[model samples]
Target: MPEAKETVLEIDLGALAHNYRYLRAKIDDGVKFLSVVKAFAYGNDSVIIARKLEELGTDYFAVAYVEEGIHLRKNGITKPILVLHPQFTHFEDIIEHCLEPNLYSEKILRSFVETAEAKNQKNYPVHIKLNTGLNRLGFDHPEIGTVKEIISSTSSLKIASVFSHLAASEDWKERDFTVGQIDLFRKMTWELIADLDYEPILHICNTSGVINYPKSAFSMVRSGIGLYGYGNDKNIDPELRPISTLKTIISQIRSLDKGDTVGYNRAFKVEKPTRIATLPLGHADGINRIYGKGKAGVFINGQYAPIAGNVCMDIIMVDVTNISCEEGDEVIVFGGPQHPVKFAEAGGTISYELITGIQRRVSRLVIPE
Candidate 1:
């Protein structure tokens, strides 16, 4: 793959395949694997990532919206695509593309039934989401009865799987809470499936959940962040590999005096004479202003720079006085070694925020194995 002319996220499809194989090996061979390709595959080009995972024989693909699933289908992804959060507004389009919806709320369940009936689809796959402890999406224990009623009443709609999100899977300190969620999901499953003879596949493991909570492994596990790396569990045998590399280049360099201020409103005042290199990416490019004035910065020429001043929309200045770097050289923003800017620590945000926040304007170049 050719290097970016300016700034880009190099997506390694090989690494992606590796991560897929790694995660798949961790679970049972019969259990299905659903790779979450939502948010442009975590802001690294959904079509490309989904294509790679699909080629690897992944059981299913997931996205947050109907449009995203349609995009994957448009790009030749025939593998099952699951829409985690389907809005009622796009029900018809979702039907046209044959995308399955994870019906969480009672409103969504009733709406989907009507839409499925209108579309005249038979046995249309749909996932049942449960709100064990997260309290975000999914039906509660009391609502599962309603869900079962809806499932039985609705002819064409079929319950594909029942899933729940883990609040804190990696923190063993929160093991009790995680266990409680698993137990709750399991308890609710029997009641939820009460009259229905066939058990829809049950999946409750998130990336960290899959890694840390083995007993909770029901029928499938939704591996998102772990597949893209950044998982916290060290005990996971296959090891998670980061599949995306965010890179940018210094646009210019300027020498500064001790008393001189930098960036908007003089957010940072130079403590000493310094050589500052300004990058061609900022909040507009997913490198938010939260890194401004006090955070560590991009690594260049085997040395780390210090972020200085308020991050502008299209530019950020870093103190590179101590490093040997010049304009046009690539700057490692987040990912890779020798600096390894953990996305979570980028600005006190999580990896999901960092990856999903990358601007669409930034070019994404895929590197196939």
Candidate 2:
């Protein structure tokens, strides 16, 4: 990859392919793989990532909203795209873009059915989300009959898949809870599918679920962070490579004398004479303010330089006292020797939040396979 002159997010499609194959190998041959390309493909270039995944023969793609699915369709993505959280207002647009909506509620289901009927659509694909253990989205067990009644009442809509989200599949401590979720999903989906004219794909595994729960690999599986190169498990992380590298360069170097303070509110007081390097990216660029005050560091010339003080809107000062670095030296914010998980841990966050929080302003360079 080319050296970074300014802050940039380098996306490696080769690594993405590797991760896809790794996850694909974990499931059965017939099981379909749904790549979750939501949140701008988790803050990378969605169009580029989706294009590559589509080329790799991903069975389906998933996004958080209708606009994201529309963006993918506009970018020539031909595969089926699942809109996980569709709103009533965007139901028409979702159908217009050939995107499937996850009908998680009665209101959404009825609204989408009405919209599809209005459009004179027949057998429109839609996903059913069931709330097993994760209480965030999806219909509860009590609503399964109502969901079926609504589906029965509409010819404009068809259930393409019935799926649920795993809340703690990665945590072994929550094994019982995870298994219970899987069992509950299976029971609910089976009950719902018993009377249907056709079989809908049943799935409930996320990346971690794919790794830990092979038995629950129903008909299809969804992977988000794992494809971007995170398995959410230490044992599996090494087997996959992170696809995005957040890189920046040392814009300037400052020599601080004893008793000198740096950044807003004088967060960092120089106990001894030190050299600090100012980077061209900061909180606005996705390096959250919680990573400030020596909480996190960037890799400079193979050595780690801790963030000196508070993270500003467009800049950050790192203590490069011990590192032999100068202005314009490539600094790895994450996705180098240190994984994004490390940086996220420093701020009490996760790789998902850290990566997805990356702003759209950062330039992206794709490394093709």
Candidate 3:
């Protein structure tokens, strides 16, 4: 590895493949695997991660926007890319890039069809998103009739797939809700298929949905965080490897007396003699201030050093008194076997927030296979 930088996110493609294979094992051999590479592949460099997954034989790729799909297309990604939340304004670009848009509303559906027609395109692939339980996006069950009517009337558009999002696939207590979602998804898609002359692929399983409801894997399953080495369930997490590690080096070390304070607002006061190590990472680097006040810790020389004081925009101080570390010693915020879930849990959040919140400014080092 090159000399330690101020801070870096080390991405291990090998671990990513491991997670993909593990998730693949849960489904039947014929079920297609769709890797969600949106949000920069959950902030792990979508282009790099997508390339690897492409080589690994992913059946499809998904992103949150049309531009994200365009980015992949620009970088030579030819596999079918799904724009999960496409905007009407980008329908032309979506067609230009050969990216499938997830049509969830009447306006978007009509707009995309008109745009495709104006562009002289025919039978452009599109996915329909149903509002099963996550009211955030997708059309309601009643609107399915309107959706079918619009698609049936359009020669410019074709339904490539039908899917929905699960609101709580990870929580066993919400098993009933998930089951309801699965049932509704199946019913809605089946009805839509029966109404149409041709059948499109159907899917609704996200990462957690894939693990907890494998039987609901209809035609294809989308794995987002799970492919990045998190199952959203503790029992299954051990089988996956975290693909990204946020590491930084200590910039300086300070000794504080019993009365001395650290960081802005003196959020942390030295109750006893303490040693603090300042690192070149802070909220600006995706370490939220909520992780301050000893809520989060970083791994240094095999020992966990708790955060001491408020997190600044460009720096943070850690209580490294008991750790055997020096200036420039590498400190791991989260990654590999340590897992970001622990950090998220300690900070009153989830792993998704930690990983996706990582700023694009942070350097990402991709590990060779």
TM-score winner, 1 or 2: 2
User: Against the true structure, what is each candidate's TM-score?
Assistant: 0.94, 0.98, 0.96
On TM-score, the candidate that comes out on top is 2
Task: Pull out the clashing pairs in model 1.
Answer: none
Error of 2 at 172 (Å): 1.4
**What are the lDDT scores of the predictions, listed in order?**
0.83, 0.93, 0.90
Best by lDDT: 2
Tens-digit lDDT track for model 2 on 1-369? 899988899999999999999999999999999999999999999999999998898999999999999998998999999999988889879978899999998888888888999999999999999999788998999999999898998889889999999999999999999999998998999889899989999999999999999878999999999999998888998999999999999999989999999999999999999999999998899998999999999999999999988999999999999999989899999988889999899988899899998999999999999
lDDT of 2 at 168: 94
RMSD of 3: 1.4
Better of 1 and 2 by lDDT: 2
Can you write out model 1's per-residue Cα lDDT over 266-346, one digit (the tens) per residue?
Answer: 988888998999888889998887888767577787678878889899998988998887788888887664222354476
Give the Å shift of residue 151 in candidate 2.
1.4
| Regions of model 1 farther than 4 Å from truth | 1-4, 234-238, 338-343
Better of 2 and 3 by lDDT: 2
